[model samples]
Target: MKQTDEVDDLLTRAGARWRADQEAPPEPDLEYMLSGGRKHRRWVPALAAASVAVIAAGVIAVLPDPKTPTAPTAQAPSTTAATPDARTPQTIAQGNDDFLVKPGDKVQVSGKIIAVPGKTPVFCPPLAVPDIGYPPGKEPAPSCPDNFAVKLNGLDLGQIPGLSTIKGVLSGEATVTGTWRGGAIDVDVQTALKPLDHPAQTELECPVPPGGWKSQPSNISSTAVTKFLAAHAYQATGPIFRYPNGTSRGAPVVILIGLAHGDADAFRQAFEKVYRGNYCVVPTLLSQSDEQRVTNAIGDVMSGNPKLGIYSASGPGLYGGRALAQVTAYTPEVKAALTPAGLDLIRVIPQVRPVR
Candidate 1:
């Protein structure tokens, strides 16, 4: 069968299988191999069935070849912009995993080259003995999570050779191998990396907003200030959102904070004024000093209802801000999954509140 025809058939079967499922599949694992041999793993499971279907079709052809010099040819959805000279370095890595470049580095039997660091590449760190797992049913989104895979991020090649099998399930273990040629290690091989442990589950009550007020968008009339407030809404501290099947419905008190210490009151007031009438809003008179608290809050809200997200300006209370706009809104996985649906995480740089 032609590759395209084969892909279509595979996709059709995968689609049928997915539709038959009573509930949606949990999010796939998203693996990031960062530059400079580092591997950082952030588990977010909000993938749709279509995403998996896409993989099911062409997956067989996207695995790394044990005898080829390059990795597989699968691509993942990415938000990061391409960097100049991203491949100037000889090594590839995730957040921390690094591999010294031997001429024969291509000996791995099978693996995905997730990303090639601008500097030296490294091995992905072994999965640490985990004391905890992420919420159940949500795994990192993976382009191809099956079989031995190789996902190199920086460099691009037309096609890889020697890879024979590619599916959408992780093998959970990998091996490294190489060949010797021309004084350099002909680093070509196949191996599998262990699939991450299945994510766990946590149950907690969604807290009601401190008061029965929801932030109203109109409260902040100042164009600049309102933008900050409108981007985030303080909803009533009761349940406003839920999972698709009413499995997980949570009410989380949300606060959109300003990036700077000085603007805390403005952001708080803006958020409070807008949502107050509809829902209770919590006002953090003082900017938050703890990231763990914010992470906890975000995790809590998302767990209760995967579709509700927090919006805030870049500042000390909030996490680091890099995207142009400090103000953005989204649900943990809902917003991210919406990327395929055309919802982008808006970035708003906080300007001086326009004089009324």
Candidate 2:
């Protein structure tokens, strides 16, 4: 009985201890959840790596394209380099350099003969040859036009039939080269002509007297007249002179004579006072009525034979009227191509300076 009682008491005490343990607070579950969170952390790093790759792909799509190099283009023949009548050549040089002349453009030429391989003749515009004097006459003042220049030279009227047309002068297969230009064109041109050397040592000069005026022209003093006389004049002769057009017969000089009736005697005195040589004091005729004579005189001057120069003793239109008259008489092209600027037309007037 005593042993049974002791066992019961021990059981009771153990039970009491179990009850105390149950009454205490429960243990925290945080460590278990924390362990699970730590296990899944590797997935976060994997997701970050995938995001970085996607961002890099997007950047590449927005970049600009790179540039590549391009090739150069190709080059046509020059009018200056070819023969006057020859078909212009097509070559590399033609393509590279720009030519001043093209088809359908008018041009003026001034140059010397070098080589000619073609058959066509080249024509030059009228060159300025000063010293062809005006016709005779007595006037109050000088008869020379205000803008007249001593450099005024004769033009290439055309060819002289018997003497030498361009074909004969340049000869067959001749070559001519010179500095040529168009008045309106800004570029300087180098030109070539075929059949180069026909007009051998031909000379051109102003007209002389006696055979000069066969018939007096009524319009001689009109401003529209181109032919006139100068009291004192300059002359151009040859060696270098060429006649693309042929020469006229009779007076070998192409005279631009000025006429002024009673002014003739006065011009004689002026000529004597200003010049003394083969220049003689000739009496002015009442009428200079010879057109053929004048033309022949000019033709003779252009002929390559004996070089000659003409003198004008008298001039009626002087001072104010002289320039206007001259502008009307000699400036055909200028009148035709009138511009407000008036830069193309050259004006000449005699100023009181020491005559040398």
State the lDDT of candidate 2 residue by residue for 1-356, as single tens digits.
Answer: 11112223223323322322232233222223322332111111211222321221111010111111101111111011111132122221132122223322333323322112232233322122233345553212212221221211122212222222232233111122222222122222333332211112111222445544331112222232212232121110000111122222211112222221334455456534432122222211111221112222222322321111111111111110000001111122332222221211112111101111
Which candidate achieves the best TM-score against the true structure? 1
lDDT of 1 by residue, 299-327 (tens): 33334442222211111111121111111
lDDT of each: 0.25, 0.21
Each prediction's TM-score against the native?
Answer: 0.24, 0.15
In order, what is each prediction's RMSD in angstroms? 21.2, 52.5
Worst 10 residues of 2 by lDDT: 317-326
Give me the runs in candidate 1 sitting further than 4 Å from their true place: 1-185, 188-190, 193-226, 229-263, 277-356
Question: 287, model 1: CA deviation in Å?
Answer: 14
TM-score of 2: 0.15
